[model samples]
Target: MKGFESEMIQRLRTSDGWKFFGVLPQANRGLAVTWWVLLLLRGILPALFAIVIGRLVGAVQRGQDVVGPLALVGAVYLPLQILAPLHRAIGANLGSQTAAWLYDRLVLACVRPPGMGHLENPKLTNDLTMARDFDLGISGPPMSISMDFIASGLVEMIVGLASAAILVGYAWWAPLLLAGGWLATHWLLRESAVWRDRNTEEVRDAQRHADYAYRLAVEPFAAKELRLFGLADWTVDRFRSMRSRLVELRFQATKLRERPVLWSLLIVLIANIVVLGSMASAAADGSLALDRLVTYASAAVTTGMIAFGGLSWALDCSAAPVAAVLRLKEAMEPAGALVLGRQPADGLPAREIRFRNLTFTYPGTDQPVLEGFDLTIPAGTSLAIVGQNGAGKTTLAKLLCRLYDPQSGGIEIDGVDLRTIDLDAWRSRVTAVFQDFIRFELPLRDNVAPGGAPDDFIQSALADAGAAGLADLDTVLARGYEGGTDLSGGQWQRVALARALCAVRLGAGLVLLDEPTAQLDVRGEAEIFERILAATRQTTTILISHRFSTVRHADRICVLEAGRVVELGTHDALMAAGGRYHTMFVLQASRFGTEDTEEEGVNYDVLT
Candidate 1:
C-alpha cells in the first residue's frame, strides 16, 4: 500500500497537469496570482447564485421581504459575468509571456554549450522539434488561443467540485454520489478521449513525418525542384498520406471505446436518479422545505462539472512543450558539454602546434578518420594538407578549432595540452574558412568582420582577398533587402576569404583555410594564395585543398592518404622524389598542358 501510494504521488507530480500549474508562475507572478484569484471566484459564484435563488424563494414562501435576496443575486451574478472576460484577457498576456520564456530557455540550451555535439544527436530530434513548433499552431492551436480554452476547462472542473461541496449541507452521501460519478468519467474514458499521451514514440514519429512532408510542400528551398520535377501533386499526396496516418494513429490511441462510455453514462445516470429521487420523496413527505429542495437540486445539477469539457485536450497540448523545454534545459547541457579549462590561451601557441599520436573518430562512427596522426606546425609558417575526399583533411581543421576533442591522444600548444586551455580564448585566437561556412544575410562589413572592426581594416582585408569593389561595405549580402545583392560562387568565396583575413587583423594567431578558393580558376587561386600568405606571414596557417596550384605555394606541403601522412616536403623536393605528390601534380599539370593547347588551336582554326 505504501509503495503504491508513493508511485501515485510521483506520477501526479510529474504529470503534465501539474506542470501546467508550474508554468503559470514562470509567465508572470502578479498576473498568475490575479488569474487564480479570479478563477476561484468564478468557480464558486454558480453555487453562490444558487443559494441566493433559494433564499429568494424562501422569502416569498414566508411572505417576507424579497429585496435583500434580490440584491444578493445581482451582486453575485454581476462579478460572475465580468470575471470571465477579465480572466481571458489576463490569460492571453500570460500565454504570450510563457511562450517567450520557453523560447529563451530553448535558445540557451542550444547555444550555451561550447561544443555542437547535442545539436547533431538524433535522440534529441523529437523533443527539439516539439519545443520549436509547439506555439506555431501547426500540431495544435497556438498557446495564446489555447490559454483561453485551458482556463475555461479548469474553471469548469472547479465549479463542479465547489457545487458538489454545497451538497454536504443536505446529506454527506449526496455529494459523494454526484462527485464520484462525474470524476469516474476522467479515469474510465481517459485513453478514449483527450487524454492520449503524445510522448509515445509512434505518435511522435507520425508527427515528424507529417511535419517533413509539410515543409517540403511549403518551404521555398524545395519549391523550384518540386515544380521542375513535376512533383507538386506528388508532394501534396505525400503530405495528405502522412497526415492521414497521423490522424489514424491519434484515433487509435484516443478514440472512445463504447463499453467505457456506456459504463460512465450508466454510473452518472444512476447517481443523479438516486440523489434527485430522494430529494423529491423528502419534499413530497414535507420533510424538506421548498427553499431547501431548490438549493439541493441546483447543487446536484452542478456536479456535471467535467461536462464543460476539453480540460484534458487543452491542458495536454499546452503543457507538453513546457515539459519538453524544461527537460531539454537539463538534458542538452550535458549532451554537447565539453570539459572546460581555466588556463588562459592568449598568444601561447607562440611556439608550435603539435598533434602527437592523435586518433579520432566522429561521435557515432566506428572507423577512425584520423589515426595515429602526428604533425608539427611551427609558429608563423604555412603548411598545406592535400588529400582525397574523406581522407580527414577537414577533420584536422575541426580539431585545431576545438570543435570536437579527439577520442585518444591530444594536441599540444608548445607543451601545454590543448584541452587545458580556456575554450573561448583558444577559439578567439583561431579563425577559419570552413568548407561549409555560414553566409550570414547581413551587411558585407559585418559579414567580413562579424565581431566588429574598423572600416579601413575590413577594407584592407577585402582587398587582400581580391574582393575589393565587390559591393559597398554596408550593403546586405542577401538579395531579399532593398539595397542588397547576391554574389556568384567565386565572389562568395572571396568574401569568405576576406572574413578570415579580417580575423587575422583582429589578433587571431592561427588561420585554417579548407578549400578556400575552390570556386576560383587556377590562376586566380594562385594569386589569392599569394595574397593570403603575405597577409598571414606572422601567423600559423594551415591549408587544406586538392588543387596543386594552391598547395605548391605553401612553405611545405603534406600529402595524406588513408588518414596517414605519406609524404611531407617542399613542392620541388616532393616532385624530385617522384612520390604520391609528384604523380598527382603531374596528372593535374598535364590536363592544361600540350594536348589541351593543341585542341584549343584546332578549335580556333575551325571557328576562323
Candidate 2:
C-alpha cells in the first residue's frame, strides 16, 4: 500500500514537475473556488462557535441570562457540521465520475488500434499502474490528488491559519507548531518521492512476478501443460517465492517512507507542547483573557490536522492502482493503427493485384522475410502459390491484406498503389480463411456469415463446405454457448470455408487461402478443393497450399524458394519441363507408400 502511494504521488505530479496538491496550485477554477468558500465557512463557523460559547460563559459568570443564545448557537453548529460533509461528498463524487469517464475514453482509444503496440515500453506500463491505483478511495493517489482532495486540503490549510493566527497572537511558539504540521506532511511526501523513484525498476520485477503467478493460477491455456507435466506443485512453489520477494521489496520501500514521517511527527509533537506551555504561562501572567482563551481553543479545533494525517495515509492505499491507470492512459493514448474515415473501394482502375520487387523484414528480425519478391494475380483469375514451410507464403498474405506494409517496393491493387487507397476499403473486397481460422462460438448461421450478412444462403455455404449433415444448421448454431459444441478440426475448416463463400456472396471479389485444408483428411481435402473451385469460378483467388493436387487445378501456379518466386507456369507445363514443381510433386506423391510419415529431417526424398 505504501509503495502504491509513492507511485500515485509520482503520477499526480505533472510531467512538467508541478505537484498536484501544492499550496496555491493552478487547478480547475470552479473546484478551487468551491473549496476556498467551504474552507472559509468551516474555519469561520468554528471560530464563531468559540466566540459565542465564550460570551455565554462570560455572561453567565456575570449572572446575566445566557441559555437562549447558547442554544441557538449550538443549533447552527449542527447543520454547519453536516454541510461540511455534504460539500466534501459533492466535490469528491464529481471528481471521481470525471476520472472514470476519462479512464473509459482512454481505454477505448487504445482499443481502436489494430494491435496493443503501446504496451511495449516500461514508462507506459508504469504510468498505467499509477492511473489504476489512484482511482481508489482514501487508499490511493487518485483519491488524494483529485479535485475534491485539492480543494479540501487547501480549505483545511486555510482553516489551520485561523487557529495559527489565534495562537501566534498570544504565543510566539504557536506559529512554529502549525509550521511543524506542514513540515511533517511535506517531508513525508518528499521522502516518499525519493523511495518511489528508487524502487520503480524493482516494482516492475515485482509486477512480472505477480503476472506469472496470475497466469499459473488463473489462465486456462497453461492448465493442460501444467497438469500433464506434474508442474502444478512446482508452479505453486514458484508463485510463492515470487510473491515473497515482491513483499520484501515493498516492505523495504515502505520503511524508507515511514522514517521521515515519524521524525517529522515527533517535531510537530514537541512544537505543540512548547506552544501549549507558553500559552499557559501567558494566562498565568494575566496577558491571556479567559474569553480570548476560549476563542483560541475553538480556532485550534478548526484545523483538523489529525484528520489530514489520517487522510494522507488512506490516500496512499487508493493511489497505487490509480497511478497505474493514469500511466496506462498515457501509454494507451498514442499507440495503435490509425484508422481514417471509411472510403469507397469502387472505381479502382485495375483489377490485378501485384507485388513488385518487394523486400520485407519484421521489426526486431535480422533475416529478411521477403527478398525482392514479385507476384501478380491477374484480373479475374486464380493463382496458385506453392512454397516450402517458412518460405514466406503466409507473410505474403499478410502483406497483401495490408496487415503490414512492405519495407521496400509496394503492392498495387489494379494500377492504383495500395498506399494510396483506403486500407479498410481494400480489405473489404478481399477475404481470407487461414489454417488457424477462428471458430467463433456464435450460432452456425452467424458463424458462416460472420463478417457478412445472415441470409437465406447460409444453407448453401454449409452444404458447399461439407458440414451439410451436422444437424439443422440453425439448430447447431443454437446448441452451444458452451464452446459451440466443439467442432472437429475438419469440421471447423469446412465452417471457415463456408464463411469465406458467404463473404464472396456479400460482394468480396478476391480471396486469399492460407493452407485452408492442412488439417483435412484426403477425402475432406478433395471436398475442399471442389468447394474452392466452385467459389472462385467467378472471382479472383490467390491459393496458398502445399498439396500439389490443389495447385495443379489453378489457372497458373507459382513456386516460391527463399522468398523469391522460382517458378511460374501451368501445372502441366511445369510437369513436362520436369523442374522444381515436377520434382516436388513426384516426391510428395510418393509419400503414401512409406510405412511411416516423414517429418523435417526425413530422408524419404524420391529423388534420393
Candidate 3:
C-alpha cells in the first residue's frame, strides 16, 4: 500500500500529469471550483444517508415517533436523486470543453515543428495514437474521474470513523478489526490497479494494430482494390487475428486480478461474521437495548458497502489512463524545439538561389538521398530537371521548400542562408505542385483559390491553367455536400494546377511544378506547359518531368542520375553531345517515329 501511494504521487508530479491538473482552472476557474464543491457534496451524501438510516432504525426500535428521522432520510435521498442528473450533465459539459482545449494543444505540439522529422519518428507516432485514444468526455483524463473517487474515499473514511465510534460501546477492539479489514481490501484492489498500469503499453499496441486493420478494410481509398483484388476476407482475417491476441492477453490479466479480489472478499466475510455475531450475543444477554442493536448493525453494513463498492472500481479504472496521458505528453515534446528567426524574407530573390554541397538522408535510413549535390537557378529564369525515378529530383524540391534541412552544407537565397530567414515568411514566397498533389474535397472555387484569392483572380488562374470548363466555381467537388460531385483524375489535376497558379498570383516568387502534366493528354500537356511558361515568365520556375519534349521549352535542362547532376545544357546542346540525355531523348522519340533533329523540336503530340 505504501509503495502504491508513492507511485501515485510520482505520477501526479510528472509534467503531463501536472499539465492535466493545470488545465482545469485554465479552462474555466469558476466551473472548476463548482465541480470541486459538487464532488464534496457527493462524497458526504453517502455518509449522511447511512447516518439517517441508523437514526430512523433507532427511533423505530425505541417505539418512539419515527417521523422526524424518516423525514431527515427523505431530506437526504430526495435532493440526492435530483443532484445526480445535474452532476452528470455538468461533468459532461466540462469534459467536452476541456477536451477541446487539450486537443488543440496536442495538435500544435505535433505540427508546429519546422521540419517533418518528428512526423516520421515511430515513437512519436505511437505516442500520438495513445494521446488520441484517451481523449475527453467519459473516457477523459484521470483527474476528471479521480475527483469522484477521491470524494468517495473521503466519505468512506468519515463513515468508518463514525461507525467505529458507535461500535466502541460493544468493544474497544471491534473498531480496530473493522478498520483493518477495510484497509486490507483497499490494498488488494490497489495492487490490481498497479498491475493494470504496468501492462497498458502492450495492450495499447495490440489494440492499435487491430484498429489499423479495421481501418484498411473500411476506408474508401482502399475499397475498390479490396473488392477487385479479393482482399476483403484477408483483411477480415488479419483483424480477427489481432483481436484474438488482444482478448487472450486481457483474459490472462483479468484472471490474475481475480486472486487478490478473492482475498479481499474473505476479509470482508470474516469481519462481518465477527461483528454481527457479537451484536446478536449482546442483544440476547439483555446488556444491549434493541435500538442500539439496530443502530450498530446498520452502521456496520453501511461501512462495508462503502468500502468495497464504487470507490474501489473508480480507483482501478482511473489509474492507467492518467499514467498513459503523462507518458504520451512527455514522449511528444519536440526534440530540438521550433525557434523563430529574426530575419524576414520579404521579397523575391534578387540574384540567384544556390544549393552548396547539400547532403541529406531520410530518417531511419542510412542511404543518402542527396549526396554533395550542387545546383543553381538564376532569378526569373526557368530550369527543367529531367531524370528517371529515384534520381532525387523531388528531394531537391523538398529541401528548397524547407520541408527538411540538409544533413551538411545548406541552401542560400540571394546572400542569406535559408535557415536564417523566417520560416513562414520564406514559405509564403514559394509555391509548388507535385506529382502527387492534393485533391481538396471542397467547392471548385475553394479548390482553385486555396489562398483565398478574389473571384476574378481565381478565374484568371483557372484560365491560365486551362481548367475553365472543369466545373462551375460554386460546384462542390466531393460528396456529402448539397449539389456536390466528384471529378476525373485529369480534371482534379487541372484544379490543383489552378491552386498553384492562384498562389503565384498571391505573390509567391519561386514556382515548382513536378510532373504537373503527367495526367494530361498530349494536346493538354503541350497547352498547359505553354500557359505555364507564359504565366511564370517573370518568376523563378523549376520543372521536373521525364518527357524530353515538354522540358525542351525551358531556358535550360539538367539531367540528374543517382543524386547528382550529370549533364546541364540546352536541349539542342545535349542532343548534339549524344550522351546520356541524348540516348534517353532518342529512345523516347524513336517510339513515335520522330527524328531528334533541330528543325522539328521532337513532336510530343503523338508521344502520349
Candidate 4:
C-alpha cells in the first residue's frame, strides 16, 4: 500500500495533464490567481450547503425562526451559480493568451536557427505536427472549449473531497470508507478514462494521414488536381477511411475492461450500502441526532463526485499541446543550431571563389553528392554549370548560400574561408533565385523588393527582368484578394529574377541562379538570359541549367558528371576537345531538327 501510494504520487508529479496549471501562471499571473480563488470557493460550496440545510431542518423542528438558516443557504448557493460563468469567461481569455504564447515560442524555435536540417529531419515530424495543429481542433477540442470542461471537472473532484471531509464529524471511519471506494475508480478504470497514449508514434502517424486527406479535400492547392482526376469521391472516401483508422487506434488504447468496471461497481455499491444502513439504524435507536443524520446523508451523496470522469479526458487534450510546445522549444534549438563566426564580410570576393577538395552528402544519406570536387571562378564573370539530373547542380547553390556546411574540405571567397565570415553578413552579400522560388501573396513592389528599396531602383530592376509591365507596383500577386491578379508562370519567373536584381542593387556581390528561366520558352529563355548577363555584369554570377544552348553563351561552361568536374572550358574550347561536353552539346543540338537523336544508348527525346 505504501509503495502504491509512492508510485501514484510520482505519476501525478510527472503527468503532462498537470503541466497546464504551471502554464496558467506564466500566461497571466493576476488571472491565474483569481481563477484559483474562485475554484476554492466553488469547490467547498456543496459541503457548506449541506451543513446549512441541516440547521434549517432543525430550526423548523424546534419551532424557531428559519430566516437565518434560509439566508445562509442562499449565500452559499448564489455564489456557486454566479462563479461558473465568470470563471469560464476568464478561462476563455487565458486559453487564447496561452495559445498565442505557445505560437510565439514555436516560431522562434523553428526559425531562430541558421540551418535547415532540423526542418527536414524525420524524427521531429510527430512533435512538430502536434504542436503546429493542436489549436485547430483536429485531434480533439480546441483549447478554449477544453479549458471550460477542465474547470468543471476539477471542481467536481474538489467537491467530492470536501464533502467527504465533512462526513468526519459523524464518524471518522465513515469518511475514509466512502472516499476510498470512489477514489479507487481512478485506479481501476485508468486506461479507459485517460487519453495519455495520444502522443505515441502510431497515434501520431494516424493523425498525420487523416489530416493530409482532409487537407486534400478542403485546401485550394489540390482542388484543380482532384477535379481533373475525377477524385472528389475518392478524396472523401480516403478521408473517411483514415479518420476511421484514427478512431480505432485511440479506442483500442483507451477501451474499458470488464473486470475493472465490475470491480469498481462492486466496491462502490458495498461502501454506499454499509454507510447508509448504519446511519438509519443509529437514527432509529435515537443514538444519532436528526440534524446530524441529515448532514451526513447529504455529505455521503456529494462524495460520489470523486469518481473517474471527464476531467481525465479534458485535461489530456488540453495539456498535451502545452507539453509538446515546451518540448519543441528545448529540442529544436540544438537540432538546427549552426556555428557562428564574427568576421566582417563587407566587400568580399574581390578576386575569386574556389571549392577545394570538397565532399558532401545530405543529412540522412550515405552517397556523396559532391566528392573531391575542385572549382575556381574569377570575380565579375558569369559561369554556367551544366549537369545531368542528380549531378549536384542545385546542391552547389545551397552550399554557396551556406544553408549547410560540408563534411570535408571548404569553399573560399577570395582568400578567406567561407565559414569564417559572419553568416548574416555573408547572406547579405549574396542573392539567389531557386527553381522553386517563393511567390509571396503580397503586392508586386513588396515581392520585387522584399527588403525595401527606392521606387526608381525597384523599377530599374523590374525592367532588367522584363517584368516592369507585368502589373502595377501595388497590385497583389495572389488571386484570392479583391483587385488582385495572379501572374502566368513565365511572368512569375521574371518577377523572381527582378527580386534577385533588387537584392543585387542593395550591394550583394554574388548571384546564384538555379534554373531561373525553366518556365519560359526557348526564345523567351534566350531573351531573359541576355538581360541577366547584362544586368549582372559587375557581380560574380553562377547559373545552373540543363540548356546547353543558353549555357554556351556564358563566359565559361562547366560539365559535372558523377559529382566531379569532368570538363571545364569556354564553349568553343570544350567543343574542340570532342570529349563528354562536346558529345552532350552535339546530341542536344541535334534534337532541334525534325527527328529525335539516339546515340550511345541515349535518347535525346527524354533528355529534352
lDDT of 1: 0.85
Off by over 4 Å in 3: 1-8, 15-25, 133-176, 179-200, 257-262, 286-289, 305-339, 364-367, 386-391, 547-549, 575-608
Model 4 clash tally, residue pairs: 0
**Residue 419, candidate 3: how far off, in angstroms?**
1.4
Instruction: List, residue by residue over 1-608, the lDDT tens digit for candidate 4.
Output: 99999999898777777677888888888888987888778788988999999998889888899999999989988998899999899888888888888888889988987877667767778778888998998878887787788888878888889999998988899889999998887556656344667657898889989999999999999999999999999999999999999999888777775346888899999999999889999999999888888999999999988884336677777787788888888877777766678888898778999999999887667899999999999999999998889999888998999888888999999888898989999999999999999999999999999889998989999999988788999999999999899999999999999999999999999999998988887677777889989988999999988876677789999999889999999999999999988888777757655343222212232242
Give the lDDT of residue 23 in candidate 3.
67
Model 1 poorest 10 in a row by lDDT: 599-608
Give the winner by TM-score. Answer: 4
Model 2 root-mean-square deviation: 7.1
Q: What TM-score does each of the candidates earn?
A: 0.90, 0.72, 0.83, 0.92
- Segments of candidate 1 deviating more than 4 angstroms: 192-196, 307-311, 364-367, 479-482, 519-524, 546-548, 559-562, 570-608
Better of 2 and 3 by TM-score: 3
Tens digits of per-residue lDDT for model 2 on 1-608? 99999998886674212322332223245654665566568655655676677777667766787787588678758857786776677566545554665467457655655434454444465455444433643123454245545555545655565556656656666665655665565556544445453236676567566556756877887999999999988888888888778777766665545555567667666666666666667678978777666766665555435335223332333333444554555555455353343446773323688889999776445688899988877877888888788888888887777666677898777766777777777777778988778766667777888655755677777777777766455544434465446677777888888888777777778888997877787556766777878866878888888876667778999988999999999998999999998889778866765533332212322322
Cα RMSD (angstroms) for every candidate in the order listed: 4.3, 7.1, 4.6, 3.4
Clashes in candidate 2: how many? 39
Q: Model 2 misses residue 262 by how many Å?
A: 6.1
